[model samples]
Target: MAIFVHYLSILLISAVIFLLLRAYRLRRLRLPPGNLGLPFVGETLQLISAYKTENPEPFIDERAKRHGSVFTTHVFGEPTVFSADPETNRFILQNEGKLFECSYPGSISNLLGKHSLLLMKGNLHKRMHSLTMSFANSSIIKDQLLVDIDRLIRLNLDSWTDRILLMEAAKKVKRNNKSLVGLGPSRLSSESKMALLITFELAVKQLMSFDPGEWSESLRKQYVLVIEGFFTVPLPLFSATYRRAIKARREVAEALSKIVKERREEYEKGERKNDMLGALLGGEWEEDQLSNEQIVDFMVALLVAGYETTSTIMTLAVKFLTQTPLALAQLKVSCWKMSGTDFKGKNHRTVVKLLDDVIDTSLPW
Candidate 1:
């Protein structure tokens, strides 16, 4: 008992000394004003709890009220500054890699790989950003992407029937009960799943010209595992989710690497294609030819970004539209108009305009 108590005292003293040293070091820096919260865990728990609630702004609002729009807090095992001021955010974005560098959590950086565009710095980031933007330019969207989007959406909508639950359909729920007494397997419904499939298919088409198939579906399943760990604690030993994510990330990388190698072989054989993978291998950007590993990492990051966030935005748009009758009515009218008209030149522009309005109004943040 005496020995145990002595060791406990030593541990406590060490922790105190570490915190004191941290505080002293922090004091030297001109950090924004805010509480750092508890030691080790910091304000992460509070941040997570706040996000779980519908009105998450209170967490920031209370802090902003006390300490202004820009404040400091520790999250994901790092000291971070929260900037709510639009001007500060604009400045930060405008001066990326000059005044500030990309500083994602260790887990995110590990999962995304060093070559991922989200972690790229300086000249490399500029080049990749320009390349990505080139693919997403208005010409590409109107001429190529919009056709796929229209077809896929219409195909998905065609499958919808009366009495179908939108959220359940989106989520791809497998079971439904017709009566209190009877329970049986029903047609799957999930807006989120539908959105994921649509976006994933579109992205795969654009990136690799890969059609939706068993292989793509399997890859998508692995990606879901990777996304689940994005915001979790980074300790693999303590976090089963993180461990699974790490494993899944490796599998995803391997799969992408194989595809990239195959594509490179195809390119070398004088078989040219017009997708993003082809663009990478076609020596279009001869100044800096990305390695196979870099290409794979880039694809993985793009797939995650395209698949996850787009689906989330779609799901949220549905949720928000359901809540707001006026917006929902306007959206329905727009959809009706889109469906009734031929999707050509002027009509396509009108459809795009309606889509922009829907996106603008439906986004929660």
Candidate 2:
């Protein structure tokens, strides 16, 4: 018993010394003050919880109070510095290329592709941005896109009967409508709502010149997988989300490569479509057109950008119109004016203004 106790005492002394040495070494590194939670996950859950709250500002405020304007914390598997200082943010932005390169978490970078606009840097970023803007220029938007947007909006608005948002309702269960919650009889079934959103997604997909055919369904499924895996803890190989995302990304890349090849062949044969993809390829090769990978990334960016947000916006707009009869009446008046010759003056500027007002009113934020 005496021998065992002696060995245990030695082991405890060694552990204490090791911990002290580690603490001293860490202090020497001058890392800012804050907790670096568990391995892998770090403070991700806390960060997520902060944003999920009704009043999220308190999360940052509480942290700032505890650990000055700038502090270090492990978040999303990275040792990140959270700064509430204005100067630090401005300095970082101004020194983006020289001092620091813009970056995101591994999950985002891996999912968005290395060549994506969000991931690109220096001249590559400039070229991609310029290319995208050229395709989405004022002329294209005014002549082609505005008409598509108007037509799509009108169609969606016309086919609106059941107007309860299932996800939102689930968050705050105040109703027992079986149909609205996908339980019983309803005008707009859950499947139909999904189909409608898919149709809207295809309308947005047209901005990239992808025909709303078989590929649309495949792309939509992949999109859901990618988005689901985007911000999740990336265990790579071991994680289901990570694996799904990787598979989806590969499938997306393959599909896009096939489309690119077909489009290129079409362009070569003198059959140029009037979509963004067509615009990108139709122009003469000035400084070398985008590669298949780059094109795919651009299309993914645009499709992801427009898909859910537009669907949610339209859904909320319909909901707001139903709840607020006065707003609905005003919107009806605007729509009536928009369809008349009087609103057609000044290149339909009046109609556009009224529509914008109605949209602004409908949107919560």
What lDDT does each candidate get?
0.75, 0.65
What value of lDDT does candidate 2 attain over all alpha carbons? Answer: 0.65
lDDT for each residue of candidate 2 in 1-365, tens digit (9 for 90 to 100):
99999999999898778657755865797988976665557677677666544455776787889998888776766767888999998998998888988788877778888777787777877866786677666564545555555555455545554764544533232132121211112344443355345554555456556544566767777877776666556767557877898889889888877888898888889988767778667674435877878778877776666555665554555555556778778878867756734323365576577668767866663
| Clashes by residue pair, model 2 | none
- Tens digits of per-residue lDDT for model 1, 1-365: 99999999999999999889878777788798888876766787787666555457899999999999999887766778999999999999998768877678877889999899888877888888888777766464456677777777777766676756675552332132111111111221355557777888889888988877888888988877887677666778877878999999999999988999988888878997778888777645656678999998888889887775686676666666666779879888877766756556787788788878778766554
Q: Please give the clash total of every predicted structure, in order.
A: 12, 0
What's the true lDDT of residue 52 in model 2? 43
List residue ranges in candidate 2 displaced over 4 A: 1-31, 49-61, 85-100, 157-159, 162-204, 211-214, 284-287, 308-328, 340-348, 359-364
